[model samples]
Target: MKIEIWSDVMCPFCYIGKRNFEAALAKFPDRDDIEVEWKSFRLDPAMPEVPRYQENMYQFVAARKGISYDQSVAMHEQVARMAENAGLDYQFDKMLVTNSLKAHRIIQMAKTKGLGEKAEERLFYAYFTEGKNLSDDAVLTELGISIGLTATEVKEALTNPVFQHQVEADGAEASRLGAKGVPFFVIDRKYAIAGAQPGTEILKVLQTAYAEWKKDNPGLIHVRQGNTCAPGNDCTN
Candidate 1:
């Protein structure tokens, strides 16, 4: 079975959802047979490439949603608590606000090398915990190196427009799937789970999908020939 996840690196819920899904999958019996693919989704494609120190994350969120800075801070605090529950330490105060297009493209390049999951994890950690700048080429190059990607490969992917289309395609597919937000999970292209659901809920969905898949595709069947007979010449042959 294949699972495709559409998420943005800057989305706090995406990291939390990833943890919950992993927890559920770890308890699943057929987890070894599952293939996970990470798809790109950008929350703010038009955001400028600036360091978080210039304008903090709270201010950016406040301006974007037309909410007060205090409200944005409160929202971020709530999300931080939720992240702590999921074993993540989110430093929203230090978090940077930048365009994720380059990050998404790097992820797309990592996907080609079968390191998509690693890239996603590293990017989430860098942005949420370390508060690194995602738009900086140097930072991205370091991230790529940490994930076992060659410096040359990372430079090529970042400098050129090689994986831009792949990122755009993933975004387009997310729109077509009617996904209004990040952290959308699709199982076998059949079951859809949105948002950061609980581990128990995710486990139930996984089990249900696996059961249905088994029911639809039973073990292979053998057909017997009527004209060609075995040595015993029995129809059972």
Candidate 2:
């Protein structure tokens, strides 16, 4: 079964959701056969690559949502606690608020090399834990290289029109699927889970989808078999 996750690296919940889903997958019996594909979704496409002034993430969120600065801080604290429960350290105070387009491009390229999951995890760690700027070419290059992508490959992927298009295409597909937010998960195009749902919820859906999928993809069919002896007996019929 194939699982597609539409996520933005800047979304704090997406990282938490990734961890939760991974915990669920670990307990799944068919996890080895599951193909996970990371799809790009930009939380703020219009965000400037480089802000003119030093950016404060809490202030930015407060202004964008017409909420008070104190409220923003409170909400962030709540989310940080949730992240801690998921074994993630989200240093919101040290985070850099910038566009995640180039980061998504890196993930798109990494997918071709079968390292999409690593790319996603690295970028998430960079933005949330390490507080690196995703818009910085040098930062993106270093991060990509750390995930086994060559320096040349990382640079090319950042500037490649095809990778950029792939990023946009992924967002477009997410919109078409009626996902209004990040961390949207789809299983085999038959079931969809929205938001940062718990591992139990996600596992239930996975099991349900796999059950239906197994019917169409049965294993170990027996062909015309002759009279065979037991393991301890002779092979003569």
For this target, which candidate reaches the highest TM-score against the unseen true structure? 2
Q: Tens digit of lDDT per residue, candidate 1, span 111-201?
A: 8899999999999999999989888899999999999899898987887765887888899999999899979999988999999999999
Model 2: lowest-lDDT 10 consecutive positions: 49-58
Candidate 2 segments exceeding 4 Å error: 52-54, 219-237
The residue-by-residue lDDT of candidate 2 on 1-237, one tens digit each, is: 899999999999999999999999999998877899999999888888875333687888888789999999999999999999999999988988888899999999999999999999999999999999888899999999999999999988988899999999999999999899979999999999999999999999999998898887898343666888878887765
* Per-candidate RMSD, Å: 7.2, 5.9
lDDT of 2: 0.91
For all candidates in order, the CA lDDT equals 0.89, 0.91
In TM-score terms, candidate 1 sits at 0.89
In candidate 1 the C-alpha lDDT for residue 159 amounts to 72
